[model samples]
Structures are given as C-alpha cells and as structure tokens.
Target: MSNKTILITGCSSGIGRVTAKYFQTKGWNVVATVRSNPEAQTELNTLENVLVTGLDVTNENSVSTAISEAIERFGRIDVLLNNAGYGSYGVLEATPEQVIRKQFDVNVIGTLLVTRNVLPYMRRQKSGLIINISSMGGKISFPLGSLYHGSKFAVEGMSEALSFELETIGAGVKIIEPGMINTNFAETVGAAFNVDPTQTEYVAFVSKVMEGLETANSNHSEPILVAETIYEAATDGKRQLRYIAGADAEKIIAARKQLNDDDYMMLIKQNMGL
Candidate 1:
C-alpha cells in the first residue's frame, strides 16, 4: 500500500492537483504532471513521495516522456488518472476547425495515447486502474458548448469499451463524471472560446448560457469531493464503470435519465431563457 504508485495528468490544478495530493496522503507514490515547466509545480514539488513533471498531453513526445519518467522513478504504476481536459466554449458554427481538432486532441486522443502506453505495462504486471475524468457535460449537452460535449462524449465511449478489454488483463477502467467543481475551469473555458466576433446571431444565446453557467460556478462543489470520488473509483474492487462525483452530478444525470432527449434539451433551453 505504501509503495503503490499512481500517475496523474493535468496536475497543475483542479481535480488532478487535489487527487495527486490525496493519494500521496495515503502513503502512495504520486507522479503528477503539468503542461508547464516542472519548476512551476510549486505545491506538488514540495510534497514528499510525489514526482512533479512536465507533460503536455497533446504532444506525443511529452506524453511518452512523462510515462517513461514515472515508471523509471517508481518502478511501476498502479493507476493512471486521465484528469487532463478542458471545456471548449462557443457555438459550434463559430468555433474554428482547428479548435475542434485541438479539443479532441487533448480530451480524446490524449486519453487514448496515454492509455495505450500504460496498458502494456499493466498487462505484463497483470494489474492496474485507469480513471478518466469526465463531466456531467459528457452525458448532458448544453447550449454553445458543442465542442466540449463532443470531446467528453468521446471520452465516455472510449472508456466504456476499454474497460471490458482491460478487465481481461486484470486491469480496470472507470469514468469519473464530476459536476461543476470550484476550479479555474470557468476562466480557462472563457478564455478558450473560439467564437468569431462578427457572429452576432449566436451572441445573445451564448451570453445567456454563460451567465447561467457563471451562477452555477458560484455554487459549485469543492474539487476535493471529485478527488475523493476518484479515490473511490480506484480502490473500489467492484467492476463498476461510472461514478458520479457530486450531488449535482447525480441529480443532473438522474434528471437526464428520467426525461426524453427532446424534453431535456427543451428544459436546458428554457433555463437559459431561450
């Protein structure tokens, strides 16, 4: 237990940062990665039993180097937490094709590449876990966030299929569907929007939705809650596939399940005053 290691991506902040620290607290070796320079990972750098490194998931060299470095340091990795992802905001029509490509590159392709790299080791060792950090957004869509939802939906689908395949090798794969958490996600998503300034037709609709999202953010749950759920998913020996991280996540997922697609979409539009 004390020597167990978990390699997590996107450890710069939010759920990734918290989960890395949380696992370290339980006496496990933690390999945490940030896209920025390793010297900038102040908090993680100071922690004992934690290895802070640079990893840009969308970059092939960075991803391979991170995994190699983690294994070289710890000897083995017991869990791989795919916590690196961001929301791509704006209407689909307004979003550039390059933005869509980058969005999927990080959220979907990065996840695939990392998992592929880790599986060989896990398969040889006959044990491992992969916890993908998804969102309620993955299951439920919203106005003007088509790209974000698309990436998450891709994550969910891939994780689902990989779970069955990995289980054969004594490994596990699970999804963490977190609701809006208190994080820099809002600011990041705001700055990440690829909307064209001249696209005034979607302006009003996007603004209303953004306002509602801001209100939601103000009331969002703590990131530590999602981290705790990540822990649950890792340690829970049962072959469960998905663990909803917050009360709101559970509520929204349940609501979506109870309503038809058209009804859910209509309700969402009404909430944004469309």
Candidate 2:
C-alpha cells in the first residue's frame, strides 16, 4: 500500500466522489469533503483508509476544520485536489449578481481557500502536488459560458503562476483541464438558465446559442476518464503543468493552440451552430 495521501473536495458526487474512490482503490489514503455530513454516502462511506469531512470551501471555518481533521487522521497529506466547482450558464445581462458571485466563489475563490490551508502541511513535508481542476472551457469560450469560463480561466492562470512559486519548495502544481464529462454538473448548468420574459430581445439569439452548446456537449467522456487523469497527475512525479483529459478536450485545446483569437471564436461558433 502506498502511504501517500490525497485530500479532495466536493465529494458528494461527480468527479470528486469518483476521484476519492479511485485513490482508495490504489491503496492511497483519501480525505474526501462534502458540504455537509449526511447520514451516509454509500460510495465513499465504505471505502477504507478514507476520511469524509464536511467542508464548505467558501467558508474559512469549514476549510480549516476539514484540513485539521484530515491531518489528524492521516498524519500527513501528499496531494491536494481542488476539484470542487460548479457552472452557472446564462446570458450575462440577465444573470443575477449573486449567482455570478457564487459561481466564482466556488470555482475560483474556493480553490484558493482550500489550497491556502493545505500548503502548510505539504511545505512541511517538502514534497507535494496540487492539481487544480480546470476545463477546456478555460481556454475556449462560448456564448452564455462567460461566467463559467471566466472562473476557469482564472484558475488556469493561478495554477501556472503558483507552480513557479512552489517549485523552490519541492512542491508541484498541475492543472487537469477536462473537456465535457458526464456528470451532474451538466444538469446544474442546464438549470442555471434564468431567462427574462420581458427582455425577449435576446431570447431568439440565446436559444440558438444554447442549441449550439447542446450540440457541443452531445458527446462527452465519462467521469472516470477525468478521475484516471487525476490519478496520473498525482502519481506522475513530473512537473507537467496541464494534463488534458477527454479526447474532445485534447482536440479542442490543440485547435486553440493553432488558431488565433478570432479564428478560435469563429470555430467555436461554427461547431456549436451559433
């Protein structure tokens, strides 16, 4: 059994839950966090060498308490996977201020909060890996994805710069930029649409844009693909910065590299039929 340990957030379901289970099966200790403790979590509750804690990353108290609990149980933490995030897709002008704030809070600020708390433990060990879960959307943007894409772009930039700072301390930083993965996150995004009936001026255009988005997401990789990538990111022992997950994710990112801004935007619009 590898004595190595990984601390992951947002484990109630989706990528977080799958990643937690993946590490446990690999003989690594796992600390999985959910927003609140339920009576039971069938998938994660039964796993061995795993600790489930309540953590609301946006809240300082929740973040610190979870870190303390994990350290107390495991003695040390080897990896910190900031996998807690959600998307709120909608028209920019119509989207509520609180909703946009919450989106950034969970995706960007929450990532920093969790990382800030775990850095001390990893620094003390003098060796660690921090993998922030970004998305292909981070590099490529689409209509109604402005809010979601902005947060991911922020994370992508943050991880890149932080890698330089952590290298001197023997700790490493990596980003898992996953494409469309089958998860509840898609359902959440679908539901975040808050259309304004009075503001029907943009309705027809928005509908077309959404149709294009649906086409873009028609084929998505399973969450395990991303979980496996996360596993590789943790164990690879290399300073690789961005590990792209899905096949579409790879293709899109490669295209992004070859195309300039205008071309990329045109390609995205064409692909999505916008």
Candidate 3:
C-alpha cells in the first residue's frame, strides 16, 4: 500500500475515519475527506502521509474540488472509497419527499458524482479501484428505514452495473456491505428522524425501531473490521463485486437470498417487536 494514493470520503468519523488511518498506517498516501470535524482534521494532519480536506458529498462543487485537489497533490488516485452517507429512519408513508431526496442525494447521487470525477484519472492510469460502502439494508429492508434502505438498494444496483462496466477497462468496482457496526451512526440517524415531528402517526413505532437499532449497534463489530474489509477489497487480486464485512451482514445477506419478501418482512417485524 506504500506510496499508493487512496481517497476516502466521510472520514470525520465512523468507518471512514478508521479506514483512512489504517491505510495511512500501511504507508498509503491518504486523502481523507470530512464534512466538518476540527478534531479529526487536527489528528489526521499530524500524520505524515495523510491530507485531510473538507468535503460535502451532496455538493457537486465540493466533491469535484476535493478530487481535483487530491489529484493535484498525489498525482493520481489509485483507490476511490465512497463511504459518505447517512441513514434516515422513517416509514415510507411518513417520510417526506425532501427527506427521501436528501438521502438519495447523499448516498446515490453523491457516489455517482464522486466516481465520475475520479474515473477519468483512473482510466488514464488504467488501474484503480472504486469501493462503495453499502449495508445489509442494501439487500434487505426493515421497518421505519424505508428511505435509508432505498438509498442503499440504489447503491447495490448501481455498484453491480458499474462492476460490469468497469471490468474490461482495467479499473474495478466493489461494494462493502456491513451490518450494524459500533458507531455513532444510529444515533445520528435517530436524530435525523427525531427532528421531524410531522410524522406523528408512526412516532411510537419509529421510536421502538430506533431503540432496537441502538441496542443492536452497542454489541456490533468495531469500525476497524469494516476498514480492513475495505482494504482487502481495494488491494485483493480477485475481483469480488460484493464483500459482506460482519457476521451479521453475512447472515442478513444469506436470509435475503433464501427468504421470500413476505417471509423476510415477517422476520424483520418480529425482530423489531412490531
């Protein structure tokens, strides 16, 4: 990994932050992006091989500028990690159009914009990796998370298509599907929905579901696990389109493959105490 340039988004916290540090420790030239985090910047700036920048994935200008700056600094981008996304927990009926659009903007369109900016450089080099951080939610939907699930599902579909498109081109595309990891993700998501009081009809149910997510996240795998998975996907010789990071993600993917939609919903409802 030494001397290789890897650019990662959403590096202020959670899996992205960990992955950036991990790659730097392995001697990679890391361009770590954050929306806003003074502490993260201060820490990463102290590192010899890291260049931390402010990046809002939903903004085309910000994404383009970040990628361009990274290229200018590092000469080329060897790996592009699309890990910037937030979860919006709400029933489809209760979720507003704005909320849905925001979710898609960050998760789906943001990924596309960043990838588009970075691909030309990769094509010129004729060797690069594009890794998208999806979730078990990408494959299986759960109650009170329709908007979030929808965004990840888009990621899953887009990644598959992009994998086929990039295969013959020398570049590669991979999806990292991780289940509930011990991070501030759930709290952040809960906060997103909590502020929207207009969806009062499903408040009770949504609250219960959010509680369950908090509990599940407590015993979840560490962010380092996902970081390691990203590293493998970026550097591994074999071309694997999807890599399930945690045991829970593997189980969920298996269940999604085996069960019918109705059966899966029944199981999800039962788990959520719905």
Candidate 4:
C-alpha cells in the first residue's frame, strides 16, 4: 500500500474515471473530480482511498476548492493529472470565433489553470509529478481539427518548457499522447464539426476527412491502456517527458519524426484520400 496521492481532473467518464480507479487499486490516494454532477458523486464514492469532487478546470474557484479539499483529505499531493478536456474539430474558415475561444478555454487554458493551482503544493514538497493528457493531434495534424490540434500543440509545447522549469524545484512534468481510445470523445468530435452547409468549398474535403476519421475510430484501443500508461509514467521514476499511449499514436508520432514537413503533409493528405 502506498500513501502517495494523485489528483486527476475530468473523472466523470473515459480516461479520467479509469485512471482514478486504477490508482486507487494500486493503493494510492486518488482525488477524482468532474464538472459538478450529482451522478458523478454516487458513481465514484464507492471506491476506497478515493475522493470524488466537483471541479470545472476552467473555473478558478472550482480548481482552488478541489485542490484544497484533496490536500485536506490526503495531506499531500504526489501527482497531478491534467486530464480534463474535449475535442473541438472544425474547418477554420467556418468555425465561429466563440467556439474557437471555448476550445482554447477548455483544453489549453483549463490545463494551465489547474497546473498553476497545484504547483505551489508540489513546490513546497520539493518533489512531485505533473502528467498532462495531450493527444496525437498535438504532434501531427489532421484536416478539420484546427481548433483541437491547436490546443493540443500548445499543451505539448507548454509541458516541455514547464519540465525544464519544474526540474529546478525538484518537480517533474510528463505528457501522455493517446491516439484514439474507445470513448465518447470521437462522438463528441463528430458533433463538434462546425462546417456550414453554405460553405460549399470545404464540403468535399470535410466529408473525406470525416470518413477517414470514422475508419480510424473502428480500431481504437481500450481506455485501460491509457490508464495503465499513466500509472507507468507515475511510477517509472525517470525524468521522461512524453509517453505515446496507443499503438496508432506510436506509429503516427514515430512517422512524424522520421518525415520532413512537406513529406508528412503529403502523407497525411494521401492517407485521407484528399
């Protein structure tokens, strides 16, 4: 049994929920948070060494209160998993400004806010780990995912820089890039497509990309894989910076590294039949 505590954001479903349970079973104190929901309370409260709470990562008060509560319950936070986010896919020309802002708000800004609140605790302890859940899209882009990719790209860059700064304080940062998992995240991405019918110029391209996305979703990895990866990252005790979780993510990111910019762009276009 371990006394270490891990605070995870977005525990209502998918990766967040699975990770919370995984950590609890490993005998670590777990703070599992969701965006204020009654059902979430009942669903997660059954676990031992788990504290389920309401936390809207984009809201400062919510982030502050949840961290405080976790500290109060566990006395110390050993890890912080920034997992609260959504996919925002749309053609840039057709995407509304407000939607763009909201995309950054939830994915990028929310991540930053939570990390900022938790850093003081880790800094004082002089030892801690921060694991951010980025996506393969952060490393490689796809058409109609400008907003989603943009935010993830920001996360990758930010995590890399923060790793350097945090090392000075005896803290470390790591990023997890999952390709595609069996979750409602794909459905949410489909629903978030913002192309307007009147914008006929992008229709054919969007349709093809959507088709490619559907085909890719047909072979997604299980959420447990990601949960397991998080556990490994937390326990590996190495100063590793990134862990690509899914098979698809590993292939894609590896390819991206091997190819030059233009070749990679062509490869993506060819794969999508664009």
Candidate 5:
C-alpha cells in the first residue's frame, strides 16, 4: 500500500470516480473533488482512505479552497491530477461564443488554475507529479469536435511545455491521452450540445456522426483502464511525459505520427463517413 497523497478533480463519475476508488484500494490517500453530485458524493464517501469534496473547477475560489483543504487534510500532496473536463461537440462556427468560452474555461483554464495553485506546494516539496488528462483528440481531430479538440490540444501543449520546465526541478509532469473510453462523457456531450437540424444544413450529417460516436463509446475501453494508467503514471519510477490509455488511443497516437495533415483528415472523414 502506497502512502502517497494524491488530489484528483472531477470525481463524480467516469474516469475520475474510477481512479479515486482504484487509488484508495492501492492504499493511497486520495482527495477526490466533484461538482455537487449527490450520488457521487455518497458513492465516494464509502471509500476508506478517500476524502470527497465539492469542487467547481472553473471557479477560482472553489479551486483554491479545494487545494487548501487537501493540503490541510493530507499534509502534503504528492500528485495532482487535473481530470476535470467535458466536451462540446459541434462545428466550430456552429458553437456559440459562450459555449466556446465555457469549454476552454473548464478544460484549459481550469487546468491552468489548478496546476498553478498546487505547484507551490509541489515546488516546496521539490518532488511531485502533475498529471493532466487529455484525449486522443488532442493528437487527432474529428469532425464536429472542433471545440473539444481545441481544449485538448491546449492541454497537450501545456503539458509538453510544463514537462520541460519541471524536469530540471525534480518535479514531473505527464499527460494521459485516453481514446474514447466507455464513460458518460459522450452522453453528456450528446445531451449538452445536440445538433439542431433546423439550424444547419449539415444536421443530418452531424446526427449520423453522433450516432456512430454513441455506438463506439458504448463499447470502448473501460474507465478502470484509464484509472490504472493514471496509477502507473503516478507511481512508476521511470516516468514518461505522456501515456496513451487504450489500444485505440495508442493507434490514434501512432496514426498521428505517421500521417500528415490532409491524409489524417481524409482518414477521419472516411472512418466517420463524413
């Protein structure tokens, strides 16, 4: 049983919840933060070594308070997991400005704020790990995924740059790029931003695409796979800057490495039947 203390964000359902439970089972002290999900609160509270807290990642005060509370409870934070993010699925032009702002606010800026707040303690300890949960979309783009892709790309860039900056300081930064994990994330996107047939000419096209995604997501890698990947990243002595979680995720990364811009888009278009 590892005695390392870790803080994780977005622990209501899906990957975050799974990771929290997995870490607790491994004997790690975990501070799991969720944004007011009563059921999730009840479920997480059942864990022995886990501390469940209310956290709205996009809110500055909430972010600060969560970090502070974790520090107070755990004494020190050995790992910080920025896993709170959601997707906005739609064409870039079709996506509202407010929606775009909110997407970036939660997925990109929230990550920045959380990392910024937690870094001081890690820096003082001179030994800590910061893990950002990105998507395979970070490396590859899909149609109707512009807004979602943008946020993940930002995470990828930030993680890469931060990894270089932190390497010399004995701290480590890593990113987990999971591919289409079986989770409620896709359902959330479908519920939050369904394509309006009357609003755009590509409505039918988008609907078909979304249907395909819904099917794919239903049978994708389980949340436990991502949880285990995160656990390995956090505890492994030889650290890597990025760990691709699923087989599909690894394939996406490999494709990104092998294909160029036009070819990649062509492949996506073909696969998605766009």
Candidate 6:
C-alpha cells in the first residue's frame, strides 16, 4: 500500500480509466479528469481515494482548477500523466487548416498546458514525475497520418528537452510510446478521412493505407499493458526517458533504428502497398 497521488487526464475511457483504477487498487490517490461531463462518471466517483473532475487540457482555467483541486485533496501530486489526446489522420493537402491546427492544439498544446500547470506543484515538492502518452507514430509516420504524426513528434521533442531541465529540479519526464492499444482511439484515428474524392490519385492512396491500418489494428495490445508500463516508468527510479509499451512498438522502433532513412521510407511504402 502506497500513499502517493497521481493526476490523469482523458479518463472518460481507455488507458486513462484503466490506469486510474490500477493505481487506486495499488493504494495511490487517483485524480481522474475528463474533458467534460464529469458529473456522469459514477464508476470513478464511487472509488475510494479517487477524485473525478472536469479538465479540458486546452483550457488554462480548467487546467489550473484541476491542479488546484488535486493538491487540495491529496496535499501533493506525485505523478502527472498527460494522456488526453486523440489522433486525426489525413493528408496534409486534404486536411483543412482548422483541422490541422486543432490536432496540434489538442495533442501538442494540451500536453504542454497541462504540464506547465503541474510543474509548479511538482517543483515545489522537489520530487515528481510527468509522463506524456505519445505513440509509436511519434517516431514513425504513415500515409494520411500527417496530422497525428506531426503532433506526436512534437511531443517527443518537447518531452526530451523538458526531461533535461527537469532532472536538475529532482523531477523526471517519461514518454510512453504505445503502438496500438485495443481502444476506441483507433476508431478516432480512422474517423478523420479528408481525402478529396475528386483527387483520384490521393483517394486511391488513402484507401490502401486505411485498409492496411484496419488489418494492422486487428491485433491490438490490451490497455492494461500500457497502464502497467506507465506504473513501471513511475516507480522504476531510472533515468530512462522513453518506455516503449507494446510488442509491435518495440519491434517497429527497433527496425526504425537499424534502417537508414531511405530504407525505412521504402519499407513504409511497401507496407502500405503504395
């Protein structure tokens, strides 16, 4: 049994929800937050040592309020998990500017905002961890995944830089790069199809990529695996900055490291049947 506290975002379902329950079961105070409709979260609300709240990571006021509430309830925050992100896949030319901006706003800016808001408390405490839930997409790219991949790549960069500065303050930063967790997040990734039908060439390419993704997604790792990995990163007491969670992610990232850029690009094209 432990008395530490963890604040997680995007707990409406999937990884965030499972992680909240997992930590609570381990006797950690869990602050579970959603973008909206916090009142309807009966399951987490009923759990002991859990605070169910509303936190739109993109909103500064919402971010501040959630942090204040967490500190008030738990006296301190030991871990902050920036897990509130959705994938929007579309070609750069076909994706509307607003959609592209929104993707960065949620996936990149939201992570930054939440992390900034929590840093003060963590710095004051002099010992805390910030875990950003990136994806294998951060390291590699796919067709029509420009929006999603760009944002995740930005997170990867930001986390790496932040990790260096945070170490001096006795705080650590960890990035979880999961390949494909069996969650509705895949549907969210595939739902954004902006390829113009009139552009027959782009449309054909997009179709093939989506088809390949559908087959790849059929074998997804469970969300618990990711949650368990997050727990390890939090307690492992190592200087490791990135934790690859899924088997697929491990293999793919390993291959990415071994191959040169041209070879990797060719492999990606072949995999997508391009």
* TM-score for all models, in order of appearance: 0.96, 0.97, 0.93, 0.98, 0.94, 0.98
In angstroms, give how far residue 229 of model 6 lies from its true place.
Answer: 0.1
For residues 1-274, could you state the per-residue lDDT of candidate 4 as single tens digits? 8899999999988999999999999999999999987255776798888998899988999999999999999999999999999888878888889999989998999999999999999999999999999999899998888889999999999999999999888999999999889988988877777888998988899899988888888879999999999999999998789999999999999999999999999998898899
Q: Model 6 over residues 1-274: C-alpha lDDT tens digits?
A: 9899999999999999999999999999999999999989999999999999999988999999999999999999999999999788866777788888889999999999999999988888899999999999999887778788999999999999999999877899999999889999877765766777776767777888888888778878999999999999988999899999899999899999999999999998898898
For model 4, name the residue pairs that clash. none
> What tens-digit string does per-residue lDDT give for candidate 5 at 38-143?
3458878987878888888888899889889989988899999999998998766566788989999999999999999888898889889999999898998777
Regions of candidate 3 where Cα sits further than 4 Å from its true position: 37-40, 194-204
Error of 3 at 248 (Å): 1.3
lDDT of each: 0.89, 0.89, 0.86, 0.92, 0.87, 0.91
Question: How do the residues 88-190 of candidate 3 rate in per-residue lDDT, one tens digit apiece?
Answer: 8866775678888888999999999999988888888888999999998899877777788889999999989988778766999999999889888877876
Candidate 4 versus the native: TM-score? Answer: 0.98
**After TM-score superposition, what is the CA distance of residue 24 in candidate 3 from its true location, in Å?**
0.5
Q: What TM-score, to 2 decimals, does candidate 5 have? A: 0.94
Q: What is the lDDT of residue 96 in candidate 3?
A: 72
Task: Pick the winner on TM-score between candidates 5 and 6.
Answer: 6
| Residue 17 C-alpha lDDT in model 4 | 92
Residue 81 of model 1: what lDDT? 96
RMSD in angstroms between candidate 3 and the native structure over all alpha carbons: 2.1
TM-score of model 2 vs. true structure = 0.97
Listed per candidate, the RMSD to the true structure in angstroms reads 1.2, 1.1, 2.1, 1.0, 1.7, 0.9
Lowest-scoring 10 consecutive residues by lDDT in candidate 1?
210-219
Each candidate structure's count of clashing pairs: 0, 0, 0, 0, 0, 0
Report the candidate with higher lDDT, 2 versus 6: 6
